[model samples]
Target: MTEPDPPPAGVAQALYDRRDGRLALEVVDAPAAELARPHRTNYFTAYWVRAGRGTFHADGTRHPFAAPCLLFLTPYQAARLDPDDHLHVTAVRFHANFLCVETHHHEVGCNGVLFNDPYGPPAVTLDESTEREVADLVARMRAELDTAGLAQAELLLSYLKILLVRATRLKRGQQGTAGGGVRLPPPLPELRELVERHYRRLHAPADYADLLHATPKALGRLVKQHLGKTLTELIRERVLNHAKWELLHTLKPVKEVAREVGFDDELYFSRLFRKATGMSPTGFRAFETDVRGGSNLSMPSARPSIPPPPPTGQNADRPASDPPEPGA
Candidate 1:
C-alpha cells in the first residue's frame, strides 16, 4: 500500500477539512512530569514558557527547554511535556482553515515531513527578546478574541500566522548556520518501501542503493537528512534490536540466533552484540529473566529499527549530522 499524501497548504479549509469549525487556544496551569499516551490530535500547538525548566522527550532524544523557550509540535507529532514548577505557559492551538492564507501555508508546508516526526527535537528556541515579542503577541491574541468583531477570527488567524512565521524563521536561521536545504534524493518512496519489507535482512548500503538505483553516499545522506541516521546506522540498530528480541524468545541458541540475525560465527556475533549493546547474548538473557518478568523482549510484533546491516563494514554508530528536531 502507498503512503497517504500529507495535507495540503491551507488552514481554515484544512481545519474544516479535518475538524469542522472549532478553533481555540487556552492558558492552563498544570503540574510537572505530565505524561501523555501516544495519540493523534487535529490542531497545531505552540507551548512557550515564561519561566521554569524541563526536558521534553520526543522521538528518541531529550530536548531540554529552560525558561523563555518555545516548542512547536505539529498536529500529528506524539509528545508529552514534563513541565517544570511554576510553569508560565502560553499555548496557541487552532484548526486548519485558520491558516488558509498563502503566507501561513508555507510555514506548515514541506511534504508533511516537518509535521510527521515527533521524536525529533524542536526547531528553535526563543531568546529573551523574541520571547517578549512573541509573548506580547500571544497576549494580544488572547485579548482581541474577547472583543469580537466581524474580523475577530480573521485577526486571530493573522496572529497565528505571525507566530508560526516567526518561529519557522528562527529555525531556518539556525539551520542556515549549521547547514541548510540539503535535499533528500528522489525515489524515497520506493526506498522506504524496500526498507519496510526487507529491513530484517538487507544491510549492505549497496544492496539498498542497488535496489533503488542510487549511490550509497546518496542513500546515507538521504537517511541522515530525513531520518537523522545513516543507512548503515539504521540497518545496524534494526538488526541489533531484533537480535535482542530473538535472544529472549524462541528456542534458537546463541550461534543459531546469531546466524538468524545475519551474524555467522557465534564469536563474531558476540563481538557485534557487545558493540551494539553493552552485553553478551547469554548475559542479556540472564538480565532479562532476572529483571523484567521472563523475556528481555518488547513483543513478537516489535518492528526492527530499520533493516539489518549489509553484513559488512557498517558501523558509524552516531551520524555526525542527524536530522534536525521535528517540527523544525
Candidate 2:
C-alpha cells in the first residue's frame, strides 16, 4: 500500500505516530483551492466544519452542510469539499489500526455505524450545542498535542473516543436507528470491519465466516438482515469502490490497479469493473482525469509544512463564528 500523504499546511503537525504508524492526528485550516479539489486518503477522517456552507462529496454522494457538522471518510474513500469563504474546518484524521473498532468494539461503537457503512449518508449534522462541544474537544486535542508531554497519546485516545461516541449518536439519529434501549446487531460490526480489513484478499462469505467463528449460512443471514446486502455483494462493492478511487486518483495502469485490489487477470477485472461501475477502467480514468483538469495524484507527506503561528497581541481579534448566508 502507498504511504499516506502528510496533512496539508493549515493543520497542526501530527501529535505522534504510534506502533510504527498505526495512529496519528492533525487539524486543518486549508486554503480554498485545496478544499475545492477532489482527493483521496488512506485514513479515517472526521472533518468538523466550525463555520462554512458547502458540500462534502464522499464515495459518489454529495453531503451538504453548514457550519457545526461532521463529515466522515473511511480509508481510501474519495472526498472533495466545495465551500464558501467562511469555511473554517477542523479535520481529525487517523488510521483504522490506531483505534480498530474490531478491538475496541464496546468503547467507541463506531466501526460499522460511522466509518464502514456503505449505504448511509456520510456527514452527521450537529446541532449548535453539539458543534460547540465537538469543537471544544478538538481545541483540547490541539493543546494537548502542543504540550507533547507524558501520557499525551493516552489522553488523545480518550478524547478521540469521546468524539466518535458523540458522532455515533448523531449518525444513528440521522439514519433513524436511534432509540433509548436499542442495541446494535451482534455480528454486523465485526463483519463490516473484517470486510474492510480483508476485502481485497477474501472475496467470499465463507471466508469471513471462518474467521468470525460462525458458519457461512448463519453469517450470511445476519449480514443480509442488518446491512441489507449479501456478504459477497458487500465485498464486491468495497473492492469496486477502491478500484474506482485508484483509477481516478492515481496514474497506475489498469492491470496494476486490478492487482492492487486483488484481481490477477486484467481482463476479468475489467469485465467486473465495467459491470459494477457502468464504465470501463480506462474510460473511468479518462473521464476523471479530464474532470479533474489533469492533476496528478501523489502521496501526501506525513509531515505537514505547518504555517507560522499567528501573532499574539492585544490587537489580535478573535475569528468570526457565523457562516455567511447561503449565497452571500
Error of 2 at 189 (Å): 18
- Per-residue lDDT value at 52 in model 2: 74
Candidate 1 local lDDT, 146-237, one digit each (tens) = 66777887677667667766776676554422123454346665676776567667878799999988888987776666555567765665
Worst lDDT window (10 residues) for model 1?
Answer: 10-19
Worst 10 residues of 2 by lDDT: 10-19
Instruction: Report the number of clashing residue pairs per model.
Output: 19, 6
The list of candidate 2 runs beyond 4 A from truth reads: 1-23, 177-267, 270-328
Model 2 has how many clashing residue pairs? 6
TM-score of each: 0.45, 0.53
Candidate 2 residue-wise lDDT at 43: 54
User: What are the RMSDs of all candidates, in order?
Assistant: 20.3, 16.4
RMSD of 2: 16.4
